[model samples]
Target: MGAVSKEPTRFTVEANASGAARYALGDRADFADVERGLIARFDEIKNERGETVLDASTFSFIRQGEDAPAGVDASLWRQSQLVIQLGLYKVVDHLFQVRGNGANLTIVDAPEGLVVIDCMEGVEMAAQAMRLFREHVNDKPVVAVIYTHTHFDHYGGVKAVVDEADVESGEVALVGPGTVESFNKYALGENVIVGNAMSRRASYTFEALIPHGVSGAVTQGIGPGGGSHFTTTYIAPNDSITATGETRTFGGWEFEFLYAPDTEAPEEMHIWIPAINAVTCAENANHTMHNIQTLRGARTRDARNFARYLDETLVRWGDRVEVHFGPHTWPVWGNANVVAFLESQRDLYKYMHDQTLRLANQGYHPIEIAEMVQLPDAIGKKWFNRYYHGSLHHNVRAVFAKELGTWDGDPASIWPLPPAENARRYVSLLGRDAILAEGTRAISEGDYRWAVQILHHLVFADPADAQAKELQADAYEQLGYQQEAPQWRGIFLTAAQELREGAATEGGLNTASSETILAMPMDQLFDFAAIHVVGERAADVDLRIGIVVNDTDERWTAWVRDGVMNARPQESQNVQATITGPKQAVVAVLLDPSRAGDLVSSGVLTIDGDESVLASYGSVLEDFDPHFNLVTP
Candidate 1:
């Protein structure tokens, strides 16, 4: 493999006055000021199909795909401009949008040898960034990549960052949490049971298509508020470390890895650079409060664990840290400032966790606490006040799920009817007209919280109610404008825009890579299944089997224990089937469902037992829960 450290690619960084002004506020996104500005801006806008116009002057970027050139749509172009500029931090102008992880990018400063953290969604963007990073040394090379967590935004594209020959022949070092095999589950259940709504819901949540000002805009999107969509691949860690105080050096940089698994992600960790006084918390700590439950849905994150991870990070590196950069937003420089930022992040989750549990102890249901959850003046005043990923409403559900479980304590809610059935019954009890009238009144009175609840019933009761849809859209529109969290702002605004218009047909959404999948082991993949697979599907079939990969002499068993799918490595057993093939080959086919058939045809797949079971097994699993409401009563 030609994984040589080349002469560094040289590049320059210049200040973008517009980006400087907007992001310079650091994390203090003033909601009152933001809201008023947006309301006035909204009056001048139009919801044109897929485009939600941002600022015209700033909404332009280098077009790299089949989509229209930047600025064809003011919103998309400007957002792309913002996404590209803000995400890259203007660190590399030559290196533009890669695997679009919004602001997330993977740059290899050759002089530094290799320093990549989170490859956005596009390979080209990563490639561009690599070039920019290389420019510094003129001949240095990328030696290692650090995937902070298993989330797609964290690391999705590898081919663009490193050559394939280097990955296969062992030229680069891949680092992250969980076993190397845990990351693949991100793309596993794509076909047969597609979460088409995820990209839709993602667009709804990210508001990538919306205008940036008040009415149409909100905080940015989530993760890196990531952009681009590309196939992902990962190089297995040439070295592995999975605990606190784990330090290792690659190329010239020293990394101290802190395992933050089970907090933000099932398999996640943070890296600290003692030399630069920089700490990459990955997805653990971000500008705004992250989702306890994401829209491209998975199981709710543990609030206590989420806060605890931040606390641990501060304890370990609070003194040495000079700058605090994350998967998103501007970095906080100075020891005192960094401590303050991390403390706010920690307290935000801590308060949510402590307060929510306190409410739950008071016998409050998920809905009650979510509606009531608020921060004191200190915490609420921070720039991260916006609910981007982990909105206030849904995080309460996550809190309840943690303390009381998803059962909601009420027996009736335990075995709920189909939404349509409940909708019909509820509408029957209260005439549709009354609900609509009440919803309208709530909207006028600025009781948006009430309007959301009332209109929800109207839409569910009569999915065809135009007025209800319009008013709901209006309410969501207002909420979106008011939100300061990037993801929340994007989601609320996107939803409002959609209801007012129609479902925005997304441009092109990217997929992940096999390298990234191989980095994930079967066990982590199966765990991912537990999170993404819909409960309704699991309730039907009961399947237990073991898989033995002949190529590696590896045996894995998957069972329905306690109504949950569990899989782990074990001695080979004469159970269901022993599939034979290279793990990467099998993974490539498994990455996308519709592509599963390619395995059999390519002769890479060989099943011994019921061949039909593979189809059934795939069918039984569901895609990510995309339509979940981030802001609900």
Candidate 2:
């Protein structure tokens, strides 16, 4: 999925923001040397494509205001200020980091060469970061690249940093944990549904849809928001770190891995460089409170596991660490400071996990628990511990929902009316005028939440209702202004913009790139095909087809029976005729209609199966609309 264009809108700062900004500025951000190192290390850095990656223009918003503007929280604005401080920074002797270049890329100087830890989201960005590292830090070549997790932000820009030819020639090693499996599952499996939804929601989370200005996109709280204008590609890992304490020496630099799976990411690991006395927390511990459940939907992250891993990291190496850093944001240094940082982060996730369950067992609904749960004064009061990315309220609800499914013991909610029907009934009963009056009162009383809640009925009841839409947009703007979390602010602001103007006109998702689709393992491709099969259309059809990948010497049989699609390795020859082709060609036939004629003409794909069966299979494949409306039904 990609970004949608939005016109910049102007908003005025509220009275409360003034005090909040003063308080935020006064907070002791004890990393003076780190801030100094983020000064302009280079004028500009570009990728092979001549794309500007690390430049001043993208983050020009840093100089836009001296204080928090309207429709933005002051604490968040303070975080944004730190977040936008981009440049190559030296943590210790030979340990350097490229921050604010998409995602932070760490450079470890090894005996033979530099070992890059976690490439960023795009080639352009990662390449530029490396360029800065080379010119200012070291000119040594990258002998190895370590991906801490499965997230694209951590590993997508491999080609920019190191030559694939080097990796192919066994000169440079590509290392990660659960790299291939996690990438295939998350990036390709039902991506048409999941990826599209994520892209849309992520636009809000990263604030990619909004322009950067006084009243527009500000900060992602982790780093500057980055969802647009980046080329993404995947590189498979040749070396896997299977277990915790797995020690590996890259170019004679010894490093130990902490196999921290299912913390912030599904497959994540932390690296300890005993030589430098620093631990790379990967995304497990970032500057801000990370999502137990990100706004962009996925399997809810394990809060308990997340907390325990941090605790374990401290127990294993807390005393030895002098500095700690991650894929995003600056590093925290000093043995005492680093330990405190780790402890605070550990308690942050654990507190939410423990307290959420405590509240849930007391017969409280998820929504009720969200409101009731609050971070302790120690954790909540700290500037670093504040919810800039992850909100305590939403995370508490996520914990409740994770344990108990969405079904509360209430029967009325089990079969609630769809939005439009429900809204019509609500408007009829409450009366449209009455609802509007109440919404207006709520707005007057500075209760933007109530105004948004009640006015939503009027707008949905009658989508063409101009007055309701206007009022709702106004309320959303106010709510957006009040929010401390960047995602909440961006989401509310985007909704307000959509209401005032209309949904974005541009941006489309390229769900499967040629490289990613072609590189996908045959089993994974078949598994993905099974997911995209339209069950309703295949309810009456019982069909089996064999896919023979000549290039990979693999054959898989897939059957759509009783409205379910099942696939497995071809065990016996007792099947319908086989469609033989190269792996990529067969995948293209299934997914990319644009490539059909080319593949057929080139004789890369040929089917011996009944032509009707192939046609039927094609007909049952579902194509999702990427630009589905989020604010509206």
Candidate 3:
């Protein structure tokens, strides 16, 4: 009773029947030239029973070193191979996506045990989701864990599925929403300051450290949440659901919740499954068109409240869904293709909020309606491609802040000045050979986002032009090879491989630990000091200072007005230190200004009102130096 058609051959995966690992991978190896270019780009948009179907056996390949040993260094480090073919879904049986970008992980077997939802990214994918649930559902013992969102590939593999004697000896239950102030700033706000500034374009946009073959790096065929960390930390949620259509029914799985604050995530939830009609759309109905600001920056979503939570989650579970599942990819069965894939991902977030307000009501701002908004033909011939994780110039500035708000209405574009002294007086009035010949004629008219804004002002007006920094690193590696947004193809191919290689000198930025900065929370350490708090050196010091911890009794009061670096709860006092143990013993005495009094003499710190006023307020705190440099020198 199932001979349906049009792509989607019922459920993918079926390839690599070893037979001598297919004659020990021959066809000019980089693993047979990336599986013969993903079988000739899925035979140019497949559909004849989608040819040999999915073709991704089990999955996990690494070669820029996984401590070289598999099959006697399989061709001894073939230029650091990496393919991570994601797919782990048992959702409803010891439930697992257990490592995402191949989504939907359920794990609810009951009879008083197991509860997980999303958790992908190692402990070998939570030991391959406990060996595919003790060989097909029920080998019991897990009890609880439900971090539906606050990404890092959905709860960085909770110590590879429960430990520290099962969450500090309570035996599971963990859970979500405001999860301990979202896991205390979730690994220093996105892998220590926006994934070392969007992982220098996420290692050439998930080529996992560069592979320009077939237009450079590609695993973001969407599905497999990535932020890299395995034992990162996330067991908070000793149960909390917060409003919007919440329901429970634990173990035996009834779920049905919705809350999902600030859309696609910022404290999220979505589950629904009145007995496996399945919904779970947690990265808010994925299939592409996510992210609003994210260029390693945050706090800016609401594309009209993400199209009114998918037009009220398709009027509350559009006829009890049929199958949706996600955390990254895979899973979307029938029921009219899950209500036309949640009404085309809810009209692709209402056509990026009605064509960025029909070209900002024709006045066009927000980077000229994000350089004239596109994506029609019903969300651009859906393959759910944005290559992986939201793009379209951050959803036309999330529809010009949903019709102009966070002040892009302009006062000379709201007091702008310091994008490196407005890129050194616009390269001293377009000089450096007329902004490197209008950034090499806007990268030979492919216009790569205006040739990455005229090669970021000729690499900030000549940071010693090595031929205008190697022709703006070959126009940011051909706009990170026509990006389909894996963070805008790793931020224009990690700013053209750091203007042809530069940053990352010295150290400190593979990321996480002082137990991930004593696990973040005084509201994500004031949202990671509102992203590296300098706010004009905390508004050139009006500074308040009072703080206390004495090991988590917690006290806060750090204000620094007008320029903005606020912190609350002092009531009234100049009090500067009632200090304590961990929060990296006060970020190792406030993020290093030559390790204050040698970290209060290495006893992790115990301060006073004036250890030179916590060393003149931790020298205006802001050490985000994740191996610096976004573009060139």
TM for every model, in the order presented, reads: 0.70, 0.92, 0.32
lDDT of 3 by residue, 1-633 (tens): 011101111111011122123222342323332232121111111112433212332123442434322211122122223234333344333334433333434565655667677666434455555665666545777777777767655665576677756666755667676545554354346665555565444444443444323333334445322323334444555666777677776665667777767766667777775666677668777656677665445556776666677667778987777666666544566578778877887777777777888878777777777767777766655545232566776678766875577677667868888676787788887677787788778766656567677767766766777777766666665545444355555555555555665654642224344445456566555555556656676676665655565566677776656666667755346654455545656655545535657666877766665556655556676665545665653
Question: How much lDDT does each candidate structure score?
Answer: 0.57, 0.75, 0.56
TM-score of 2: 0.92
Candidate 1, residues 1-633: lDDT per residue as tens digits? 012111111110011222223332332232221122111111111112423222323322233232322112222222233233332232222111222235456443433576677775545445555554445334456677777776565554556677657755667776767665443343333311234445555565665566543244323533223233334454454444567888877776677888887778777788787766778677767756788877655656887887788889889989888766666644455689779888888888888889999989888888888889888868865655445456677887787887778776777888898776776777889989898899889877767767887788878776667788788877775554344345655666666655665554444233323344365566655554555444666666666656656667777776553346777788546456555567766554333334546776788776667666566567655555333433221
- Judging by TM-score against the true structure, name the best candidate: 2
Rank by lDDT, descending?
A: 2, 1, 3
Model 2, runs deviating above 4 Å? 1-15, 18-24, 28-34, 38-55, 179-193, 508-514, 571-577, 593-595
**Residue 620 C-alpha lDDT in model 2:** 78
Q: Point out where model 1 deviates above 4 Å.
A: 1-84, 87-101, 106-112, 164-169, 181-200, 208-229, 497-633
Clashing pairs in 2: none
Candidate 2's residue-wise lDDT over 84-112, tens digit each? Answer: 76788877887888876548888899878
| Per-prediction CA RMSD (Å) | 11.3, 3.4, 22.8
